[model samples]
Target: MAERVWEPGDRLPSRAQIGQEYGVGENVVRRAQELLISQGVLEGRAGSGTYVAEPRERVRVVRSSARQRVRVVRSSAREQPSGSPFRADMNAVGRRGVWESRTAAKVPAPAEIAARLGITEGELCVRTTYEFLADGKPVQLSASWEPYDLIAGSLVVLPEGGPHAWAGVVNRMAAIGVTVSHAVEQPEPRMATAEEASLLGIQKAALVTHIRRTYYSDQGRPVETADIVVPAAHCEIVYEIPINR
Candidate 1:
């Protein structure tokens, strides 16, 4: 690609062919392609073949809010999308953004999720998985969990259903008379799992930023928790903190 042998949008040689030319095994060629794919240098199309990917500028994700106040406050910035943070970030970069989500009711929480929600193992919860896209390319993924007992039979039970469909966690909880106090977020850098890489169109073990965030109600009860994942090569994270003298 450096020598323009495979320009952007150019289909690459098959693994067998590349291996023969390079005097390496097909597996070696495949692994090299996977690494390049993870670095945004190539893209794989199922039933087709791999191609050099177009260069993409990294989008900036600004996590800004006025949570220092007694109540958690959404950013007043007009740039902040009321519905989805993914949209906000994409908008900042002048790209169209959208997301797809699936919600499952009464799903049993795993031990790790249960601990995060302060619930017993095997307890039921609502799990919603999201895939966020920018210009039709997958850029982020998330799995959100909410305690079933808190929202059972409510109009907001299905996060993407009902009158409040697409409303975020804060607004959905607010509709049920729960006031969110603040959220705790822990961000860590890690290698992507196979599933994550596949979903995000990256290679296995690709670098990603994972954030574990939980929203707490005014009474200090955990309202919602989520695992947010973003491809490190596709986006940069920024924090906006407000200060008062």
Candidate 2:
């Protein structure tokens, strides 16, 4: 029947008819039909006989799941995507980058946040949230936390306030004689959470790139930590690793 004696969508012979044609019992023919259906060579519809399936619409699906991972990486930039929605590479020829930030002083850190910052749970920390804009439209969100003990009386503690306002962590820490030695990053891809979706104005469950980072002082003390999120479909990441001889 598959040798072109029948047309596309043609119905195959019944189990009994096929059994007689091949000199086999109906049960044997039934098994072959079942296999064909599973392979998409044939399709069965309720209240109708099986027919040749539309193979052009063939699809193969495979899935696997494992525990989520958190990797310690060398680089950590809140705006890592060189070509993100708010970054320069993604802007149309002449658009400029813009951002709005809100900082909360002495916010109690959550347990998980405390652990990352190497402080006891509920310790006070400075928390800052930012929305990156491209032509006045938001495209990314980031939140950062720094333990109060690290910058208690420093003018740069407020993140976006004081003399060194709007300066990055590396520079701000320098104002207090704290040299930021390095940073560690853990990046992952996942669906947007409800709060993230609402703030980014994207649909729930939309795929996003979430990166968590921790900055350390030269003395190995965690100085800052941050969570940066961007729409996955709109961002592309490029990594540049230096090889030492």
Candidate 3:
């Protein structure tokens, strides 16, 4: 790719052929191709072949602690028509941002999620899964969980279907009288799972950034927890912290 030997959209030779040409094992060629694909240098087409990918700008995800908001931002001045922060972010970058979400109530919390939310396993919680897209291309995924008891009998119980529908976690919790103090996020690099790869249109085992985020109230009580996933090749995460004088 550096030398333009394989131009954008140009199909690469078969693994066997590449291995023979370089006098390496086919497994080596396959591994190298996978790495390049994960880095956005190449893309694999099922039942077709691997091809050099077009240059793409990474989406910027801005997490601002000063305002207690997580949003995507770009330098452009255009504004989105919708009220969603994600849409505003896409509009800034000259793309359309849309998402599909499904919410399930009374879902049993798994061990890991229970730990994050400070609840015991088998506790009932409301879970919402989101698939976010930019310009019709999948870019991110999120699974959010909140204890049922926290907002029981409230209008914000169904995150996407209530009066406060589509309102962010902070706003929703605030409406229920929970003053969200802050959020903590831990990010780690890992390989993608089969389900994630299919949903994001990436190769299985591709590199990705996984984040575990939890929102806490003024009393340090966990109100909500979420797992966010971003394709490493398609997005960049930025943290903006405010320094008090």
Candidate 4:
């Protein structure tokens, strides 16, 4: 049953019914059911019949469509013209999204960040760390860095502050005459670090999807880079790439 007949959420047949079908005694059927449950294939509910357990695996959806759909949806969100992409994504799935952020300026750019932004190590930068919640539960974390030299004096430097609050990388950079021409993202699935696990409220070394995203200017300069961490159990990272036919 575990190998072929039953699915992730299907309830097992009654012991007697299974015994009759398989020509086995009830005790034999009961032992088999217990073994399957212990092996993580089935679960028992109090006062309710046993059920199949939900698989603890990631669900991946790769989109081979136009990326323009994202921008279109962002513009058409009637009430909040500047609503957060995070909130929009959650609302689409009937969930509420909120994020808390702490921003620090004048920090030295870390080594990996410097490479992504094409800057020297120890260069002054602004870092904003965000914890995104869905229905009041932490589900994602984003740590973003931008070279201080680029928008030092502008209000956009304060990511969650000023008039452009919750404004995305594209709009915020545009305020300083740096039109974001494109963004590149690389997603990898790996075990979460101790810090990430604590922040995301999951177990240490739990499965997670790590995303490295960089925004670029029309002149092809890297303006900002971010490390986005999402809990595998709660998030589904989707990509909508244009199919070159």
Candidate closest to the true structure, highest TM-score: 3
Which 10 residues in a row give candidate 4 its minimum summed lDDT? 61-70
Which candidate, 1 or 3, has the higher lDDT? 3
Error of 1 at 109 (Å): 1.0
Clashing residue pairs in all predictions, respectively, total: 0, 0, 0, 0
Q: How much is 82 displaced in model 1, in angstroms?
A: 3.4
* lDDT of candidate 3 over 78-159, digit per residue (tens): 4212335466566667887889999999999999999988999999999999999998899999999999999879988998
In model 1, the worst 10-residue window by lDDT is 65-74
Model 3 spans with C-alpha error above 4 angstroms: 1-4, 66-85
* lDDT against true structure, model 2: 0.68
Model 3: colliding residue pairs: none
Best by lDDT: 3
Clashing pairs in 1: none
**Candidate 3: residue 172 lDDT (0-100):** 81
lDDT of each: 0.83, 0.68, 0.84, 0.76
Candidate 1: stretches off by over 4 Å:
1-54, 66-81
Task: Write one digit per residue (lDDT tens) for candidate 1, span 113-140.
Answer: 9999999989999999999888898988
Q: Estimate each model's TM-score.
A: 0.74, 0.61, 0.87, 0.69
Displacement of the residue 181 alpha carbon in candidate 3, Å = 0.8
TM value for model 4: 0.69
lDDT comparing candidate 4 with the true structure: 0.76
Q: On a 0 to 100 scale, what is the lDDT of residue 4 in model 3?
A: 29
